[model samples]
Target: MKKVLAAVLAGAMLTASMAGCSGTASSSSSSKAASDSKADSTAATSTASAEDEALTCTLNVWGPAEDQAKDKGNWLPTTCEQFKKLHPKWNITFKYSACSEGDAGKTVTQDPSAAGDVYFFANDQINTLISANALSELGGSTVDEIKSSCSKEIIDSVTVKDSVYGVPFTTNTWFMYYNKSKFSDTDVKSLDAMLKKGKVAFPISNSWYLPAFFIANGCTMYGDKGTDESAGIQFGGDKGTEVTKYLATLVANPNFKNDADGSGLAGLRDGSISAYFSGSWDAAAVKEALGSNFGAVSLPTVNIGGSEKQLKSFSGSKAIGVNPNTKNPQVAVALAKYLGGADAQRSHYKLRSIVPCNTEVLKDTDIQKDAMVTAQNETFEKTSIIQPFVASMKDFWTPTENFGKALISKEITKDNAASKVEALTKAYKNPVS
Candidate 1:
């Protein structure tokens, strides 16, 4: 299959060159004719080299059930079909199966050889996937095309050690979802103001959302950008304790609610909650519940130590990765690229309402008009912080969750906030030890 595609590409290049020479033949000098002939020869040689590197193999692909379902215009199967058309002789048979993006990293790490040749996963898994030697690095034209096609932040999310390890499909992060009828535009900008209007459901017990408070107070998880595993936890000292005390106050407010389940969505639907903190995954349901009253915006600022600080949500991306252990490594990489490419991303947007990461797709006027997409873009630009992909980050979730729960439960207070912060910092810095 690869050879056939190569031959066809080579023929096309040579034909185009020959046609150009024929058009100029009557006016061309001997030197000019020789130069054109040389150019043609170069084209043929490059095509031959590319053909030699072309891949021919069946690939196993994994993604969410919705992305693989035939009825949903699943991008995986559609992408595979399109890829096969481009590489006619390539005997590319894709075995599609169910695997959520969140589980892909752990699955690949557990058994690289048995994992899918191409799989969808969250960006936070890059460090662990690379450490397990489970992901393949993209190179050559593929890497170039990816860099040209996606946003800089999207590209950076999948890049490790200056090499791209995956192709980003969609951004996976939280923005603010609120009931417009309950709170005005100005009301939503201040967390304190929103709380006064009605109950606001935020999963304060979850580590994912808990960091927003500390981040607003200028606390960091690891060193700069969450890299440098050796740097350990920086969520201590004055800023950390200050944020902790503030959170203790917020949780004590009657309008503050802790909900980890779909209860928040239920609250929105029942008109009991004015606003909530969550991502695009809940956009559809919230839209349905609020109808014309639906409003999505960037996270609001919160009062901290007598000053208001912008709440910074953790930002991430969902991407497609090639397994390093695949028998057809090149084919796997190609498949990963195809799944996250422009066409596939557009399809994802139309079918799933997923905000595409592809630069061209994002520029589409219709995509730009989407409220969710616009709000998310604004959030990423103004208030989002990149979630680190380092291995040490694995230690952050449990300790942070415990700390958040303790604060909400009234077990940690202003007087004891410093000591508790110190102990949690020590545990986070030496999780395994």
Candidate 2:
């Protein structure tokens, strides 16, 4: 939004820059495997006549400005060129548009038919895109490749009603960044430990960042796998109150500070804070601030009510999707698959420091060596939960944000943590229209 080793080299130098497409992708296995096999066959034979005819078409594609950069070898255009070479039968004229993955779904929903035939989007927008009938149900080797390349959770994130629609490129989540000189290796594993020893900043007032506490203490949204809308949100009762009480104590601690208005990075720069939480987006600033003292890790455990709970960040992916409205469905699907497959992800990493979510690419010698990649991959697989993207999720943010604001304002206290949590739970279920 947010490590391993000393990472003596600045992560900024390693990764380069952060793009805004935050969130990961995923789907169910047995059904997906069967679907993949069937689709693989159809993909091969369905376009046979088109291949012979040498179909020519003008294709519109959309992605982040970073990928379209001419200076960086034009990842988007270069990849498109490569796709053209592979499908020599298809004479493709590329038309490009600058659209961030995070904004893809909303923008496309406004006018799906007018949107690019192929585009990159955040996985959390799956539901919204589906509701608007803006996302196409992907099939063939593209579906097979996605199944083979990504983790189950990654696959599930892009799935709506058991069908996968997007091809994932990289993980989207947050982790801890610390000054190595201030905290020991063991200390980095525990949030309370870091807080006790050095100045620590956390985004306690932000809804997106606040859920780490509740998630650690057993709160869940849309059930365990985050796919069941009927399950509703489970962020209530004794478990929710426990987290509220913990946060109250955390905010009252002298060594703790709430990150807001860029104070986290400023604190790191001025040497006022020893550690903070964020995603790959802040790597450069953190690296420049701490230099040789830079360190990173997955979310740490927190001691809550005499018990240690592992804090889990919300994780998702940025992926490439196809529009069913495309007149040239065959070419559009092929191009979409090519852009998000392992090869494209590798190129994306080289060009933009966009970490790859493809399992095969993650094992590359160079990729494996990057400490930031190691930390991010670990957090994506271990200390993270998928952010539910169902329509019901719209009711989540404001109420959670209100709770966070109250915590920072001291309106929420250990003395009334239970009552406050009860109120938040009610708000979650009965969000005002």
Give each model's clash number: 2, 18
Q: How far is candidate 1 from the true structure (C-alpha RMSD, Å)?
A: 10.1
Off-target runs (Cα >4 Å) in candidate 2 are 1-51, 70-73, 430-433
- Candidate 1 lDDT, 71-122, residue by residue in tens: 7677668778887776554456778879898898788788876788788899
lDDT for each of the candidates? 0.75, 0.78
Query: Candidate 2: how many backbone clashes?
Result: 18
Model 2 gets an lDDT of 0.78
Which candidate should be chosen as best, given lDDT against the real structure? 2
Local distance difference test, candidate 1: 0.75
Query: What TM-score do all the candidates reach, one by one?
Result: 0.85, 0.85
Question: Residue 345 in model 2: shift from native, Å?
Answer: 1.0
**TM-score of predicted structure 2:** 0.85
lDDT for residue 285 in candidate 1, whole number 0-100 = 79
